[model samples]
Target: MIPAMPKPLTSLLTLLLIAMAPAEKLRSETTTDWPSFRGPGARGVAEGSTIPTTWNADPESETNDGMLWETKVPGLGHSSPVVVGDRIFLLTAVPDEGETELNIAAGGNIDAAKDSGAYKWMVLCYDADTGKELWRQTAHHGEPKATRHSKATHANTSVCVDGDRVVACFGSEGLYCYDLDGKLIWERDLGVIDVSKYDIGWGYASSPAIHDGKVAVIGDDPDHPFVTVLQLTDGEEVWRSDRSEVCERSWGSPLIHEVDGVTQMIVNGFPWIVSYDFATGEELWRLEGGGDNPIPTPFVSHGWIYITNAHGGKAPIYVVRPDARGTIKLDSEEDSDSLVWSVERGGSYMSTPVVSGDYLYLGNSNGVVRCFHAKTGEKVFQKRLGKDAGVIASLLAVNGNVICASENGTVYVLKTGPEFEVLAENPMGEPCFATPAVADGVLFIRTTKRLVAISEPE
Candidate 1:
């Protein structure tokens, strides 16, 4: 039996105004197409789209209500799909036709996957409207230089698009640039980026960011951790900053934004969070103390930059002003001159938080979701989505609903408000580790086996 449709939020007009006003002013509006990770500016909020509240995505089901189409993507990948215009692009690593597996569950196992002999790092493009394979290019083919976690993948980073060019970073493999038609323009070898934890190989997952014709990538390895910016046109090195002194290791991506005529890139890390000038790679501001194993990317919303991380008994949320300078080490939750407000706890470990209306939504790997006041550090409400359900993908806010996908293959649509209310719970019928992407009116979900597109029935 099909589930009933979820009720829409009551404050639609207020949310539309509040979410779109600051988004438009900052030039990070989540429009019809999602360009990068968590959409533009990593806000994870989409507008002018209709996302289905319920769906049966199981291919063999007799009646597939909200399922538009599903296609089998080769091999394993945790990279989320990125949509630009009518094209969708992603990356995957295919072993040499051997038995490979990904443990899609909630556990405390800190072991690496068995070494697959050789892998083909591939770049695939598809027609967004029909889920048709437009083209596929082999970026590289060889044995992996670094090991991956049992729950992770070799293709862990999502691809970013700028105009007609798309960039993919395969960690230790290399960074490849390609045209929209599967033509390789250039590639760069950034050395061996072995992202580990406590001397254990856990793999790399930091994605790339594009802004003002420059591509930025962060490699937080045990040794020689750095942030490098290259020209998007020809892959020319603009500047690279050494981050070894500030952070030991990080898996979070870089966030680029323009504030008061200054372009700055912010990165989330443990023990310290830093911001650098985008043009010259000079240090602009730094914040001391955060979660240990940082994974969530920093994003801007409500005229302030929001950064969060978890692990090592410290889960903090820091809201900083865009025009901040120098170093800041928080001693309390009070509002500093540069940092608007901070909280010592209540941050997600893997899932990135999303802001909509006057509330900010966050979820941890345990499927415990919380809502907080966006401007001030006040807790609104906390509720568990489901027992035994785990969330690794980030949250998505669209059409007045917060989309939370669990590793147990369920997507919960919660209404946006201060009170706790779950409008709908839809199952994807497959494990999901990557975040969902929305474009035009279709919702793209990269499950463990296939890429499923959901939309309202005609």
Candidate 2:
């Protein structure tokens, strides 16, 4: 015999049910959800009709007219913000005290003003409409093992959101999963992380990509050079593939593409752009020519895979034809036949190449952006963006405009064409490393100190 519930209580229960209903329904819609590092297929291309090409072009205004909303963030990070419908997610970290010990371990000179106590891993949730912080999750409020020279606080990785579950990887700390409302689901520890190879550099920065039902993570540990795929529902290890030729870990994100009805997971790490069968985690094909430290994600177009080795000692773009069998090497002149063409000048070190129609565009860390023909790998146009601006974030194409953010928190919006056209330059006044996310007419930019929303004025 249960007692009758009050009317207000019943109404509240009904409201709660309505709120939870959307989370379940969102699983059915694919295009609106950016579930991985660079959106669907990891292509960094968003599909929607409302992306803006020109907004607030005049820089003389006292306030940003077309800006939607802006909110300040805690700490700094190079990881980009991920969007899933109305909620935007970002990862950040705050370093701990004992400046000398942590700095020494990180292989850097101690700076009293820059040192902050015990690193705190944070995941923040903001309203995509108003740029308001709805909730935050902080993990492991302690000092990290060490830091990387060019690494940021939130350099662990970007967030991947699938329906109600959002996954974020904080190396050394663990991998975390949260519900859409910011409730902790589960966290898995990957063990102690050390940067012995890159001279005790920063932790992992590869964002996870989800395909079919597994989340793919490239764990390039020296003892275990493998890609780990986990079940999306329960975070269980599905399959792990290990191969010979141990390569160093890179900051590049993995990409998923379909070629001739076969789905392949393409990962560009140091020394290789290895493709794996999405379902079984089997190494299908490998294109080896990257530098000793590959950090940019590979872009595919015109039946060719374009990859650049940032510090490969040589500045050359490796264009490989993926129509071959296992492990194609471009070491010799004969082997270079499979290679379409290699451009040795004006390549990128950090920024991933963006393919717009038939042209491939890339910005190097030295602020030089170049465009190349997609079919023949021929250089089309090149221009220097900022005099001293170094780009650590990938370029974003929205409504015919190429939006690129720099490490100094300035976003240069240029028109994509055979020639460079500077449209607008917006500054957030803080360091930024994450690529911009454009969806449903709104542009999302995450800086070290804030998350800004730029859109057409109402």
Candidate 3:
């Protein structure tokens, strides 16, 4: 028989045990997970109020004053770095220098570079705290038969990650899904890409978007012109939407947003800004007049959808509403009830626009950054960011500054206001086409040769 315990002793023990139990972490909207192309919910707005208005005093010192960690990445890709909890993921291609076998089955050509061998697709994972490489997943290695512009790379598309898996699409090579530990789960070959028209442009750059338990991709190949949805678990084809005309291939990623209370995936491709019901791949509305090769991802806000086409002959910013779904005519100048407004002047051809406080900001390929009134389509301000052109990366707003990264490796930080005030110009010393990702007060920047992490000194 055990001796009876004292009431006071037992009660104290219970209280101590309860207090020792681990507390559940609170979910934060301000401290967000930069999950997709822009950020959580596909909205570019970051939650915190203490965003750095001025660049940290010292960028090079490792002092905890602001910068957390900065590290060098393996290869080159225009794809931006995606951040999850403690890990940041980036996709790149390692160019082989000599005698590489050609994987012609993937699509297109197999020309071996006499000097540089073949380009191999690689996905990199880095530690957010220390900037250490966690693991590297090499998807494929072979001589790319197809040729892309000198500015493009094999791994130009950004990678998307969910809970335990990371997904990346290497055009012509295939779509690959890997576990957090670098284990290959599944792969789907989209076949070799035909780039004969655009001078054999680089494979494909449209990043995949996950919505409603499905991974959706717009595989607008000339041969198989369709927008397909696949099961996120096993990579099985769920449904494919067929279009009458073979849509021209573009590097723009599809945007998923709710318009007038209905969830829609708005895509700006060759000929139109087509809206599809997110539940089913059914075309809901189409706005035909746009630029020739629409590459920038479309953004939506305040019930109106904004879209732009870059070098496309008739570049225009189309304001569309889903209310006029089936009744509006495409070429009517009588103000189709669906199209609220269309502005052709001062629109971006390559970079996507950033919306903030009733204003929209955009940077063209020529390094000119402009702001427009979101509702009235009024031009607010336009200024040149860098002396040379090529502002392909999208604009990002965090804290109170509007950030734009140039291809030449300069990041211009300006206050988000009516007048353009250059706060600070930060350089990574390498060329970059990837956008910046801000998390936990640190900024993740991917240049052609390395991935750098900057933060305010503690």
Candidate 4:
């Protein structure tokens, strides 16, 4: 080694190196972890992927198109699979009599399971590569204190994984935190959250979103509606903002978007589409018009935030700028002062719309798929999916195709563009309601019976 530099020269070099460094290093998200509800930022866009056009659940096949492994999950829940490095995490509720079938369209009017038994709220882990299960941890074991919607399970909320702990919210049951090795870290009980607007019991289904080392969850029940954030490292309340008493129940999940230089958490709710400071729970802006029950999560893309909900008195798609403030209530769809564009009609119901480049894809509750210009809201094409296939899960745009799945477990792959083309209709042969998670060249699909990992052969 050469002799050390002069003290003044060394100091100058150190300063130069420090200045060259980025002020804040952005996280390079890899295919290893699916940290949240819709996978990374809930964008529903898998990066650099060539997803299979056709897949089969049957392992024994003469052809090479299906699931790599089909591992039967024990319980019934609609929570999507959250994948981490080498492992996939999901939650389920195992009732005593094994209630398997549910019709989400029934809302809260359907009859509950006859003589329902104590439920088992479980946290399960599986090997990502092969569908081999890794571990199962019991988050809660008791009779469900609060009755869920007839079409819902006790574990409608999905589990979220931070770097250190995986969080699972069982609505009225409790919120649980577990280490990667199935050890209990912490748990919080937020009481019975009966999220019914019309005095009908539609259980809570909002998954927790983790941002800036804090997990934000919404309790949009008619009884107690509030937005609460907890420390990710340790289960401590960072902030809790009480929502308006007039706000009806909302099933949409909270999402955290880092726009420009500011970070804001956007929440979808009735009577208001609210944005809050990610660090503190201070309200940033509130838009006052949405459906009576907001089920679609807010989406952020292309430097614009999109919020929309249908099946209410007002159905409007508000594309707002990141630099918004106070009240953003628009009088009509022609309000260009605050909104970039507003689609007054043809919004999503249960499915959260996804943006693939310049096009916006909407999959309705009745298996109807439509595409429109994202900025102009001009209709491109509207088509129904496979026979008797009604879509409930949100559509995903992956590898130049839109993946639209129906409750009948058929995934319709459509070519993305102004022209309408049905690419393929792959059958899962099981009941499905959750959106499939795509990462690491594998599609993790959760059905009513099992968690299947599908990938093309080498």
Point to the candidate with the largest lDDT: 1
Q: What TM-score does each of the candidates earn?
A: 0.92, 0.84, 0.85, 0.89
Q: What is the C-alpha RMSD of each candidate to the true structure, in Å?
A: 9.1, 7.8, 6.5, 5.8
lDDT comparing candidate 3 with the true structure:
0.71
Worst 10 residues of 4 by lDDT: 23-32
Tens digit of per-residue lDDT, candidate 2, span 1-458 = 99999999999999998777766364445336555666665667665535545444223456665677788877767678788877889888765543222121122332222444577788889988788899998856776654554444435488888768888887667777789888888777765543335355445777877767667777665545667788878789888777437465666677776678787777776666688888788788777644666778876767777788666475568777665457676666666666787776556876887777667788877778888887778888888887556677888766667777776556887776777788876665665578878766778877656687878766
lDDT of each: 0.88, 0.70, 0.71, 0.79
Q: How close is candidate 4 to the true structure, as a TM-score?
A: 0.89
Order of the predicted models by TM-score, top scorer first? 1, 4, 3, 2
In angstroms, how far off is 371's CA in candidate 3?
1.3
> Which sections of candidate 4 miss by over 4 Å?
1-32, 58-64, 98-100, 104-115, 332-335
lDDT score at residue 183, model 3, on the 0-100 scale: 92
Clashes of 1: 0
Distance from true location, Cα of 68 in model 1, Å: 1.0
Stretches off by above 4 angstroms in model 3 are: 1-31, 53-66, 98-116, 244-246, 259-261, 322-324, 327-336
The true-versus-predicted C-alpha distance at residue 401 of model 2, in Å, is 1.8
Model 2 quality (TM-score): 0.84
Per-residue lDDT of 439 in model 3: 79
Candidate 1, residues 39-114, lDDT tens digits: the string is: 8778898876787888888666677789888899999998999998778898999998685688767388888988
Q: Candidate 4 on 141-222: residue-level lDDT in tens?
A: 8887766666667667778887768999988888888998889988998888877745666677999988778888888887
